[model samples]
Target: MIELRGVHKAFGANQVLRGVDLVVPRGESMVVIGGSGTGKSVALKCILGLVHPDAGTILVDGQDVTGTDRESFLARFGMLFQGGALFDSLSVWQNVAFRLQRGAQRRSPVQAREIAVEKLRRVGLKPEVADLYPAELSGGMQKRVGLARAIADDPEIIFFDEPTTGLDPIMAGVINELIREIVVEMGATAMTITHDMTSVRAIADNVAMLHDGVIKWTGPVARMDASGDPYLDQFIHGRAEGPIEAVR
Candidate 1:
């Protein structure tokens, strides 16, 4: 459903992406794993058109979207940012129904709130939480709200950026399961960036490792443990001593 070929991006003097290539087939979940500052977030932003790539082509359903009309491109996908990135002042329902209040999809606030409540319920959140502000919720709750908003429009594709980063182990697991379930239930293609192996196991059908600004390995999630690639092995095992250089 999505494809990137020879994608490259650089910021002034620093080169981030170096000839990156990736693909996410329809109804599949692809998880990108990498250490800090490896350009994982940059790659996601390129796909979302938040960051324009200096070189290479990005296609959505076979349409060339590189630096194309962004509004039409973004309307087809949903994004759950690293920190949920919710508005501090908007109520939970308003946050979730944000898209419904814009463009041709605009609806009355009451109608939008109803859809938001239903989406929240789908993510296992209660109706009472819909009236609360983002500040009133816990980290886990905020993440759930973000998720509800992502799926509220029934987007064809979803992007999850470090979905489990700040949550406790149990809460992270819950979020992972929810992601897996929603992807399957909605038949939506998903691309997630996370370093958590637990998240990979629960959410990924295929896994790709990013290193030195490009994909070093890509394969089934089950093959990750036995792939025998030094980089993949080092990352999966979480060893300080391996092919990967330790961050000083």
Candidate 2:
């Protein structure tokens, strides 16, 4: 569903991405794993057209993203940010129904609220919680709300940015399971960027390791451990001693 070929991006003197090539198939989950500053997020932004690449092309369903209309291009995607990124001023329902209440798919306020409640339920949130504010919810609840918003539009492509960042292990597991189930249920193409090995294992069908501004390794998640690539091994195993330099 998505492809990036020979992509390159740099900020002044600091080069972040160089020749990043990736493919994400329809109705499948692709996880990009890398240490901090490896340009995983930049690659995502490039695909979304948030950060224009200096070189190469990004294609979505065979259409170059550069040529696609912005409003309609973005309409097909949903994103769950690393931080819950909810609007504190808006009530929970409003936040979830954000996209529903605006743009090409705009709905009546009442209709938007109803869909918001339904999506909240799908993410294991109670209807009553919809009236509360984001600040009132716990970290786990906030993440769930963010998830409900992501799927509110029934988006064709979903991008998960560090989905399990702030939660405890159990809550992280819950979010991971929710993401996995929702992607399967919606049959949506998913691309996630995370450093958490546990999350990668739970959410990824295929894995790509980005190191030194390029894809160092790529393959099925099932083959991650024995793929015999030093970078992938060092990353998945969390070893201080290996090809990856530990930030000190």
Candidate 3:
């Protein structure tokens, strides 16, 4: 459903995402794993059209997304950022329904609130929290709210960035399961970027490891342990002495 070919992006003298190529089939979930500053987030942003690539093409459903009419192009997918990115001023329901409540594409307030509440339920949030502000909720609750918002419109594609960060292990596990369930229920293509192995195991059908601005390994989740790639092994095991370099 999504494909990237010869993707390249750079910041001044430093190059990131050197000729990155990736593909995600329809109704499949792909997780891209990499260490910090390896252009994983940049690649996601490029797909979202938040960042423009200096070179290469990104295609969604066989059409090139680069230079496409972004308004219509963006309506086809949903994204949840790592930080929850909620508005401090808006209530939970408002935050979840932001897209449906504003811009040229607007849903009625009553309808929007109903959709938001339904999505909140899908993400395991109760109806009572709908009126609460972001500040009133815990970090995990905020993440759930963000996830709820991402799926509010039920887009054909979803992108999650560090969906399980900053939560207790148990809560993270809950969120991971919720993500998997939602994706399966919606039959949507998913691309997630996270370092959490639990999230990887819970949500991914295929795994791809990014290293040195390129994909170092790609395989089914079941084959990860026996993939025989030193990079994947080093990352999955969290070993400090493997092929991955540690800067002083």
Location of the lowest summed lDDT over 10 successive residues in candidate 1: 66-75
What are the models' TM-scores? 0.97, 0.98, 0.97
lDDT of 3: 0.92
Error of 3 at 218 (Å): 0.9
**Candidate 3 structure quality by residue, lDDT tens digits, 1-248:** 99999899999998998989899999999999999889999999999988899999999999999768888888878888898999999999999998899868799999999999999988889999999999999999999999998998888999999998888999999989988998999999999999988899999999999989998998889999999999999999988988899662
In order, candidate lDDTs are 0.93, 0.96, 0.92
Candidate 3's TM-score: 0.97
What value of lDDT does candidate 1 attain over all alpha carbons?
0.93
Ranking by lDDT: 2, 1, 3
The collision pairs in model 3 are none
lDDT (tens digit, per residue) of candidate 2 on 1-248? 99999999999998999899999999999999999989999999999998999999999999999998999999999999888899999999999999999987799999999999999999999999999999999999999999999999999999999999989999999999999999999999999999999999999999999999999998999999999999999989889999889983
- In model 1, residue pairs whose N, Cα or C atoms come closer than 3 Å (at least 3 residues apart or on different chains), thus clashing, are none
CA lDDT, candidate 1, residue 185? 96
Clashing pairs counted in every model? 0, 0, 0
List residue ranges in candidate 3 displaced over 4 A: 103-105
* Residue-wise C-alpha lDDT for candidate 1, range 28-56, written one tens digit per residue: 99999999889999999998888999999
